[model samples]
Target chain A: MSSVYVHFFSVSLDGFGTGEGLSREEPFGHAGERLHEWIFVTRGWKEGGSGGVDDAFVQRHDMGIGAEIMGAGKFGYPGWENDPDWKGWWGPNPPFHTPTFVLTHHTRPSIEMEGGTTFHFRDTSPAEALEEARAAAGGQHIRIGGGAKTIRSFLAERLIDHMHVAVVPILLGRGERLWDGQEGLERDYAIESVSSPSGVTHLTFTRR
Target chain B: MSSVYVHFFSVSLDGFGTGEGLSREEPFGHAGERLHEWIFVTRGWKEGGSGGVDDAFVQRHDMGIGAEIMGAGKFGYPGWENDPDWKGWWGPNPPFHTPTFVLTHHTRPSIEMEGGTTFHFRDTSPAEALEEARAAAGGQHIRIGGGAKTIRSFLAERLIDHMHVAVVPILLGRGERLWDGQEGLERDYAIESVSSPSGVTHLTFTRR
Candidate 1:
């Protein structure tokens, strides 16, 4: 069976996946790029960057990922659905080179982008969305791409099989938190943690 | 000037310092010692236990601390004030071998315990309480013992000079959160993290 995975998802020390006021101009809102600065300094993001533990873990983001299911918040900015020509934050060739399903209320026609990435809109439950993404996964693993709420919903339902969360040391006082309603999440998964030299702790949770 | 420190403060992965339904029987509430199980097996707590990273950190709880200022919640149960005979959760010889100040709206006369630990109740702000604890500290650092709200208040005022938080990899869906309203706290502190082999990440914050 193909595993459901969440890789390299970053959250602030206070558990905020994204900061307040997320807009097209500031995709991460008040958090800015602080939540993901650990990745920016890794060899996976830039050449000649540190290829230490952080790079070792971040570089695994694309391994065996066949399809992705992301929230509407991650598909684009807050009012992105109103704009007809908004492709995505990622330029022409997005990092996700798979059939990416965007969970949105306003379902639009599928837009095929360059580099094997196709945006498919779906307004459905997490279980339903996972089933659809599973069918499109072609026997490979499915990646649960998040802006925070999407991952929390899947976690609440115990859908994720493997997850890697990079906990940034900074605190984004106010924003959408990732662990709000996940009370007994530890019951289903065996968790492990490792801190990096860049001051971020990588947490991996594998289903028991 | 004496520095204020918070040592061996434990919180769930979701940032809950203590669980819900806090009462006399369930001191940590539904958390039920879950948040503190890491220290229970440490050599600091037991005679024959692991003396690794977790033990090394837990043993520092009383290091160089002349006085302690804790919240009312940490001192006793919710309605302990109503009962005139209520002393504290700890036995006659409490772990704190110094003058400990309890911040409570219902102030009481000082109680001298078996050990050097003397309970002094004060209804004052975090700064004023620190001033009293500082004087009582006799040039040694003052410890900010917590139950979450007290530590958050001290942190909000930037009164704590150092903090060591043990992040346990469990989610207590509902409880008192430690990180709420503490946005951009990293600006005031230099933070570092180390993941212990026993599955807890120890985070140390030094005032910048």
Candidate 2:
């Protein structure tokens, strides 16, 4: 069965997901970078195209994912303004050679990238996006890439099947947190996997 | 001294930001659009940009920000991984004519745009980026544009001068939350403003 999973997401010491000031140049902003300090050093990230990566966790993250789902913020707000001629920050041949789906309000024409990548925007709704995503996966797995709010939306509907988090040893003290006021979750999730290298704890949780 | 604030970020009723698969195209995913539903409607947004933008909150957010910040996820992962031809998601003369700062780990060249816009990447820490932001504002305020974890960083540290949230009437049981488990802060902040317009509660909190 196709399931929703939050993968490759990094957390801060104070439980922040990202840092402030999400600039393309400095996307994580302050602690945002620190949150991913653990993952960036992981081998999983290095294998995934993050240059000169370190640690074994990064290796795990890059290998086990087949596809990605991200929010408009993940694409850059400037990209959406005035419906201008902007592709994304990643440029043409984005790192994700795999198929990607976007959830947006203003509809856009489908954008196909090199390396077997096609960006399809769905405003139909989450359920609709999920259906389309399942069909689009082509038997490969789908990793739900989040921008905080995006992740919360799917988790609320209880549609997520698994979540992979790289718990780094740092704190944002603000920006976005991991479990800030999330209501009515089963709370009893089993750890599917765990890896420890460079003090970053990689945890995979599956629905109970 | 320049201060950072997390303004107009939204969350769903279910606590999720968007629904399901995430992509650069639909970074916010599902109802993630609802988060910014208020900002675009603000008097500021309407009076400045297109005419008679419906929502009041959105208009205000659009009216203008001191300066904007970007996170890695918000900017798009797979850094510099572009065709080298495409730019960002926004068109020329973007909504923000102000100088913007990017939070990044990789030290790349700065990206300059038209309309007094220049994208500067900070390989330093978030505080260092804030220093640059303060200088760039030249007396104006600084906005901590978020992706989730970015916002959390500021919140946990209580580095924010003010936080204005447009609580959309929706929920995303997952993703990220504005305020998670940030400890060691003065909780006695004052509620500076509150409104329930367009089924969204516009709340402003200021440090004591």
Off by over 4 Å in 1: none
Q: Which ten residues in a row have the lowest lDDT in candidate 2 chain A?
A: A48-57
The top-ranked prediction according to TM-score is 1
Task: Give me candidate 2's interface root-mean-square deviation.
Answer: 15.0
Inter-residue clash pairs, candidate 1: A173-B183, A183-B173
List the TM values for chain B, per candidate. Answer: 0.97, 0.79
Give each model a TM-score: 0.98, 0.47
- DockQ for the candidates, in order: 0.91, 0.04
Clash statistics: count for each candidate: 2, 118
What 10-residue stretch in candidate 2 chain B is worst by lDDT? B77-86
Q: Interface Cα RMSD for candidate 1?
A: 0.7
Interface RMSD values, listed in order for every candidate: 0.7, 15.0
Against the true structure, candidate 2 reaches a TM-score of 0.47
After TM-score superposition, what is the CA distance of residue A47 in candidate 1 from its true location, in Å? 1.5
